[model samples]
Target: MYFVDTLETEGLGNRSYLAGGPGGAVAVDPPRDIDRVIAAAARRGVPIAYVAETHVHNDYVTGGLELARLTGAHYLVPADAAVSYRRVLVHDGDEFDVDPVNGLGLHAVATPGHTPHHTSYVLTERGRPLAAFTGGSLLIGTVGRPDLVEPRLTEELARAQHRSARRLVEQLPDETAVLPTHGFGSFCSVGRVGTDATTTIGAERHRNDALVKDVDRFVADLLAALSDIPAYYAHMGPVNSAGPRPLDLTPPEPADAEELARRLAAGEWVVDLRARTAFAAGHLAGSFNFEGKGRLATYLAWLIPWGKPVTLLAASPEQVAAAQRELARVGIDRPAAAATGRPEDWLRPGDHLRAFPRATFADLAAVWRTGARPVVLDVRRSAERAAGRIEGSLHVPVHQLHGRTAELPEGSEVWVHCATGMRAAIAASLLDAAGHRVVAVDDDFAVAAAAGLPVDTSDEAG
Candidate 1:
């Protein structure tokens, strides 16, 4: 029997797959951390015979090269992708045997929309199609975003995406399973996505925009809904093209209270990876809170200056280690230094912990009733702000808030909020470190209207 195992990187919202029958298996779009893939293949009682890439990924570094090297498996990459290293150049209609005993193999299908050289692989058994590994081409509900490449190619790529999705549906059987690498929560997805864990070609044909709408309508709507790509994405393509070095997961040098203090004084980044509530309760002054429990990689990589030395302070060594793995996927390879303990342990002599208040929308309303007017800062993205926003609030996306702090009123206490509390805490820390008194609204945005706050829904609110 054929088995397809999914490996999910929840922090980045992407999935990789290992599929085959009894003879051996093939790895698809593996992450930078190749050990996990190695362990998974071991658990399945099969050697990995091949490692394949659907395209030169624009979101995270791929583990294909390293995984193939270690396992002695053939590495398959799109023929047209310009890469420095040697690989098995996969072309359309090419086939490779994954498990000769069970007649399991892979068939390459060119699906150029997510990237110019993007290709989808079909897992076949005995010359019959069983599964389609549609990486960044056809997703569960919506297709992958086409704007990650050059701006001039975006519209052209969108049209290509429509054709690619239609091609999969036309060529595959209704029962053929559709497995995609992007769109769980990754920024690579476009349009409204589904929450379903599994889908098939037949189901997608009825609901996917590319299959339902004409190519012109599908391309138009997709181009309009595209949001800001993460700042770290600009480096991903180049790193993957030239070839990413082997991952270095070894912990960095340890930092004591003195070193932490000196780094903070020297204007280096000392990130605190604790629960947001624990961070808000107390942390070393000037340290930024990224919340190890939240989207640590996405936000940390997005805001920190590229190539800056970062020092990590966490409650335990385990948290620091976990954050290190997440950061490495986005190309923040290693922490300059790390400390494990409480704020008291990280603080220098004569240094005290700093704190800020965390309030809900109800608390915000109570403050307004007392006739105290503080600067309400909405730090959600532009797309979210367009849906609804609190009246009379200044807007700044959290990613851009570091450079735009001067735009806020001087000497005024700022009230910060996002759709949820995680981003609010991040923004609160940024403002706090910048010497501004801040309050983080730890509540859902939906509660704003119910809390009697004036929410503007007009187009101009964004």
Candidate 2:
């Protein structure tokens, strides 16, 4: 029987797929690492016949070229992609037979909005629609933001995005699965869409806010809701356009304590990927903690200077491997060195291990009631803060905190927080490193609001 299996790239918050027929399969929107796709096809006892890319992705590097070369499959990309490679450049409405004996086929439908050349694929068996690989368009509850292309074309593409989303629902069967390549916590989505894993054309029509009949409002809200694009995104286009080399996943050389200290002294980034609370408890001085389980790639890529060599620091070899894989997704291949162990063990004379305090929302509320003055630094994004924030809390989105540190009152006591404690830990580290008395509010946002803390929405959250 033919079936479609999802391959999740969690750090990037996107998904790739392998659709297998009788003896062959097709991979769609694959990541730079092709091992999982290869393994899935091998388990299905099928050869990969084709690799399809929905667009020239700006989110992450594609493994299409490498996967095709490794598996001897045809690489399919949009005809208008201007890619510097040789393969099947498909146009709208083109169809390919994956394995005719099993009645499996792939059809390309031009759905430009996420980019000028975006395409969505509909999976068919015996000419009946089974699912649509709606890459960066017609997502589970939202469509891809249309501002990825040229600034001038943003509005034009937004209108097209609305039309394309409607076309998917109008043309496909109501029961056809809507497997989107984006929208699963990816920055590609215009706003926060529900993470419900199941999706269908009928469900989207009934529930997806972006799919409302009013195209004008959809366009307006989508364009307006586009927050800051990640700093690393600008480079993804050029790399994917020109083409990228096959992934090299070999472990980088391990750095000993002295070596790490030397690298740190030389100003190389050594990002610690332990949990936030663990990181705050005790960490190597000059290292940044971005919690490996969290959005390591997104935040690290955003903060790291472009083209800088990074040294990953983690607790276990397994964690270093995981952090390495996540880094490669954003094309941060080949760390200068990766070290795994306690920061205290890496200490030397004048090389310090630092720790910070963590507080609960209730503790903060008690201090506030006593009129104890600590700048409640709300480090969430502006959009999140605009929803609601602690009254009188200073706002500096975590991503902008590094550069905007000077804006924060010099040496002021700071209690930093985000929706959850992950970002709060990051903000706390930044504050502590800047010589401020820092405490992380290590609890949920709801806990803070319910603790009888003042909350407001009209405070010009900047």
Candidate 3:
């Protein structure tokens, strides 16, 4: 009677899980914020007996150690993990039996490749396998990118990932649940092409690129699919090894318009969490917009320099508090300051709320329908661009745009767009800052396709 509950970290595209039966339960790969996990346990009326780590996370800090400490649950970590703190060191095939009522147990399966110390945990009820917490080893539509560990180890790890995926499916039942930590929307996927967010061992055996390809092809494709690791990723491993500070969800200090401007003058990031429409119509001149409704945590965490002081620009205290919650999941525990209200109210004598025009896909398509020329800037990732893009859009990934501004054409209105408008707003600001007349395509990517705009695939795009 084992059942699994999912906890999605939306911005990171990661999933943690809780498994329980009548006897008790365990949490796997909980996020830095432990309150929710505590609440989940309380709701289920089960004491969490263990908090397990599939690996030392490199994208966000984990709450495993702290959760276990707070709840008095056993902390299970890989035997070779670099943690200086204490944990129940587990090895291949190690088994743990839960309380008598649960009729459930856990079996460790060594499945390295995402990292050297990665391990998967299998849930079994009365010796029958039910599910495997594959973590970053084998993901939904892809396997975890092996290159995040170290430069020299990339190919070796990819090969190991091949072997690991093979062993997992071979040993586990086809119907066994395949739960993973990466590849949902996170940048940690390697050669991910499908849309399924969760899959069974049988499904992976049938279609997963990692399981279906030969070792050489798999390794080649995996290496080819590596994306630029977020600049902030370097700090994650060491922090996890030493131990992350227990999360603090305190709201940031309120900043007046003048103080916020001063902070911006001093080079602090003033991120606007409002929607693209609101941000474009009015925002602090130098502020970056990730749009709090979108993947605020991932993009903001990716773009902002590590340990940089950040002050949020929002329309209300509630928005500021909401943004804080998302940022904290990635271990950005404290925002230096936050200010609410329209930017114009805080505008200094010489300063003004920057306003940029936004266009829908239809507007751009109409331009093409007419004889008018427009410079479309596609700031999506290579994979996303390949999925579909405007035939002639300038293909600079948003992260790479700041440096490649020179390559863009000069005359026509530079229109920026990503899969959704969120990335586009960020790029529009960069282009504007770089002295280009820009229009943010503040609408869904489907709009462009639906409007019968000129679109191309990866081959045609390049």
How many clashes does each candidate structure show, in the order listed? 0, 0, 0
Looking at model 1, report the run of 10 residues with the lowest lDDT sum. Answer: 365-374
Q: Candidate 2 regions off by >4 Å? A: 459-462
Residue 286 lDDT, candidate 2, scale 0-100: 80
Model 1 TM-score?
0.99
Candidate 2 vs candidate 3: the TM-score winner is 2
- Which lDDT values do the candidates have, in the order given? 0.94, 0.87, 0.85
User: Model 3: which ten-residue window has the lowest total lDDT?
Assistant: 453-462
Candidate 3 lDDT by residue in tens digits, 18-112 = 89787788899998888989998888888899889999998888888889989999999999998999889999999987544757999999999
lDDT of 1 by residue, 312-341 (tens): 999899999999999999999989999998
TM-scores, all models, native as reference? 0.99, 0.97, 0.92
Who is ahead in TM-score, 1 or 2? 1
Best by lDDT: 1
Off by over 4 Å in 1: none
Error of model 1, residue 255, in angstroms: 0.3
Q: Please rank every candidate by lDDT, starting with the best.
A: 1, 2, 3
Number of clashes found in candidate 2: 0
User: For model 2, which pairs clash?
Assistant: none
| Error at 315, model 1, angstroms | 0.7
